[model samples]
Target chain A: MRSAADAAEPAPPVRSRPGGRTARIRTQVLDAVTAELAEHGYDGLSMDAVAARAGVHRATVYRRWQEVGGLLADLFDAAGNQRWDPRDTGSLHGDLAALNHEIQDSFTEQPSLAMALIAASFRSEEAARALRRLWDERYTQSEIIVERAIQRGELPSDVDARALLIAATAPLYHHLVLLRTPPDPHLPELAATTATLAAGAGAFTR
Target chain B: MRSAADAAEPAPPVRSRPGGRTARIRTQVLDAVTAELAEHGYDGLSMDAVAARAGVHRATVYRRWQEVGGLLADLFDAAGNQRWDPRDTGSLHGDLAALNHEIQDSFTEQPSLAMALIAASFRSEEAARALRRLWDERYTQSEIIVERAIQRGELPSDVDARALLIAATAPLYHHLVLLRTPPDPHLPELAATTATLAAGAGAFTR
Candidate 1:
């Protein structure tokens, strides 16, 4: 089903020349991991199953990944190292809405990689830590959206970056992930506008 | 080793004879399910283990509940039937903050039942539906908080109750569950206050 993660990584890593055997094998194996997670979740994820799907030797998969948890940690590590620049849409509202839309898109994808990986974290501590790092990086990277807003005079100087960012994005996660509700088209704009108004009012003041 | 749900159910059920053997047996078995889930998560949940823990005959466990998924469904049903009123602390801010605190408490308890059961939903359809119903009930009940605020002139009459409620509580879940960060003591009031201001600004107008 290749469910694990066509969407997990933003784009395909270069296919042939530069990276060599180690990199190619890792890609194949990790891609298999994502597919396995999508189809079966962590409970059904196994090294043998991943090896069979990846067409790699079981001994090789075992040597590299060691276990199912290793496969998850590496999948997240691969994702963590990907490049994801928050799109600059010129206005704070536009920028935050873009960010929320991106989140909604990832979460809504068939066999959603975001959903599978997050679900994996509950059963695997290694995967959980890796998920934490990935989110930390994404959140840190997104803060520049808020930084630009401040420079653009869209927000007050005392706005707490973490608090503001979380406020702006938390509703999407709350609605999509926690409530498991069908995607709401109004959510991206509604949440962004709420965060923008609240930020303007100094609700997220440090 | 009951990781499933000491916190899942809010309190100890009546220990003695008000409910007869059938009811008592159900409670005992469900308690065992919660404990097993708490210790091992869904991956470790088993009918045998539940039977052993509950001190009920194995045939009895199999006869009624049927399987692991059945146990989760009943636990949630039991929780769904419980009486839970959103506290009226005389103001929207106080009421929402108090609501957030209760969520935080349920999610922070040792082997947090809320976390365990929510995690289980990712694996079981029955549990997922039950969770959806439970959340629906809670959200519907909590609309009174907004209703009260509108009555008290604290917010506009057009507030989208669901949207405001999600904004008010999403951060705690985002922090404790998704981001896996330590709890911030200020979170309850902070989130409640933000939702309050945003509602006043008409950000959640339906």
Candidate 2:
């Protein structure tokens, strides 16, 4: 019988020609890192294991990334830059609900990877830098939703966009990470509504 | 010179007779565990290290707690039951600000232990259970503040107390754990005010 770990092995990396050979290698290596993280978590992750899983030479992994933190930083950069895109749904509530849904889905679908990244951010400076960069990028992009809402007169002009955005997603994160609760189906709607109401009331001003 | 790790070594457990020998041993063992966690985190925590630090025999440590999770559960039980008491400041704003202050202090004062416990909760069933239990206890007690506010006509009776409480503290935890940012001195006040505003506006209503 296949072990649960083996069954959960990440699918082999897709060979892409977008950036040529170097990009393909990078993609392969990162996919392997993701798989390793899912299976063994940050503590059990090792360069040798990632290389072996990626079918790349250990020296190649070492020469490029230098260490686990560097590799993870690159992974965060790639994931954040490539995956997260701002939504302009014409209304702040719709846009926030969409964003909340995405955040909830990420946590629910890739719990191990999410938890590992969160833990690594706390434990490693490199990971922390990478995670911060990712959040900064995402937050910057998403702020437009609030900006549009302000222009549309849906929210106060002085509303703190970042604070509103963070408040919308904080409860879900607090429940998932700190409370260890299962995903609540109502969370996205609740977060969006609460954020909207708070913004309207000037709770996020300044 | 002693390294930073060695200098940060947890102080020896205090001898106490308030709860008798078994209770004293439990206290000593838990204190040692907290120290070990602070120094090395959950990944590096070992029963042998805990026993050594607690000045208890390995057999004793093994015989009682059985594993790290068991030890952590007991610690959570003790800490949750003894430490987190709800404040009755006659107003939701005052109570929430006090609660946020405590959460912020926990993260600021003992980051290592807090991060370790959080990471452990993500990685282990035992830790998750303990974490959930701790949250449940705290949320249940703190909900009374919202309940009282409703009676006092300060908030809508339909407001979701747990959601309000979680939202108030989520951003602080997000900044601390995910962004790895330095603590903002104003976080407690901001959290309390945001929560109070949102609750008053019925954003947290079910």
Candidate 3:
């Protein structure tokens, strides 16, 4: 649970949102949860600890989240909302490269959190469902990248957009999770290039 | 920890080895560890449980392994020795297909064990090293597939054999671990074909 994140420099403060009291409290709780997860991992997380860390009443946390799984689901929902916008970069390759870079940055900035969440998903069905929903949201949002590419004749009309996106990101996850190593610096570029080549060759086509 | 492996059929008995008493004890202990891991995962595993299951003395288990990490390392070593042999199938595509099929079959046959090991690796440094060593041995064994292709001029001499192997297997892991879904039956074929196309295009070459 406690690993490199314990030794690495602290992350920057969570940004203040222009919101009312309830919204502000929610943000504080979520921020505390993130820090707890990064330091102790999902298995070590506790509502009492989160409440103490957030300086909120334990009753408030109990009333709001009810359990760890509910809190995790809310966290994932917030993450989905805050996900990097994959803008149109003029071509499929450029768009995929941008997405891969964003993924790589997320992993680099929060390796322990990323690994903890993955481990949690395997241990808990609730966490797995939350993760699946999070990925589904991201996948749906990013499909526009391939859709636009198809319209521009950059990819085959029959290409499976979701499959293509998975192809681009799968190797990075493989390296981080299975190989238990930091991905190569060039991994994003290689993933983009490989997915682009495979797509162009109709390997991703239904 | 205790999940599908609890309900699924019991694994077949370990075969008797033609060796001394020490070897027989080692085999029994290893077999007990596998069954324990498959049922309770690494986190829930206890030396007492393994010793009781193996019908060996607790003192013997402690004297041999000393800790869960040592037991895991020994389990991984036994797994490496029993790993599926990836034969040369003449063509790179055929060889890759065979390898993917084996990976897919392993996952399908023992989903709980696969997931438990993955989760264990994240939680313990010793498990991570053991898993890495297991993969390294498998990757080294499978390198002959790409090497033969290079010799036949079917792949570029500069193609990275390990990277290609990783690419072919990455998506399946992504589907199983990240997506939390059963992989498509055609995934092995798709993975092999996509990797073949990408490697042919030099996407895996340095």
| Best prediction by TM-score | 1
RMSD of each: 3.3, 5.9, 4.6
Across residues B69-126, which tens digit of lDDT does each residue of candidate 1 receive? 8889888777666556788999999999998888787777776777888888888888
Residues forming the 10-long window of minimal summed lDDT in candidate 3 chain B: B1-10
Cα lDDT of model 2 by residue, B1-206, tens digit: 00111112332223333657797888788889888887788777899999999999999999999998888777766656553356688888998888777666666675356666776675668877877777677678777888888898898878888888888778877787666678898888897888888877788878
* Candidate 1: residue A100 Cα off by (Å): 1.1
lDDT of 1 by residue, A35-142 (tens): 887777677788999999999999999998898888888887777666667889998899989988888887888868788888888878998998888888788888
**Which runs in model 3 stand beyond 4 Å of their true positions?**
A1-21, B1-19, B87-90
Lowest-lDDT window of 10 residues in candidate 3 chain A?
A1-10
- Which residue pairs collide in model 1, if any? A4-A34, A4-A35, B2-B35, B3-B37, B3-B38, B3-B39, B4-B34, B4-B37, B4-B38, B5-B34
Q: Give the TM-scores of the predictions, in the order they appear.
A: 0.92, 0.87, 0.88
- In angstroms, how far off is B142's CA in candidate 1? 1.3
The regions of model 2 sitting more than 4 angstroms off are A1-19, A110-112, B1-19, B110-112
Q: lDDT at A155 for candidate 3?
A: 87
Tens-place lDDT per residue, model 3, A1-206, is 11123212232222355667887778778888888987788878899999999999999999999988877767666665553457688999888888877666556675467666666676666777877877787788889999999999998788988889888888887887678666588887888899999887888999
Candidate 1, which segments miss by more than 4 Å at Cα?
Answer: A1-7, A13-18, B1-19
lDDT tens readout by residue for model 3, B10-105? 322223446787777787787787788877887678999999998999999999999888887777666655534576888988888877776666
Score candidate 2 by TM-score against the native: 0.87
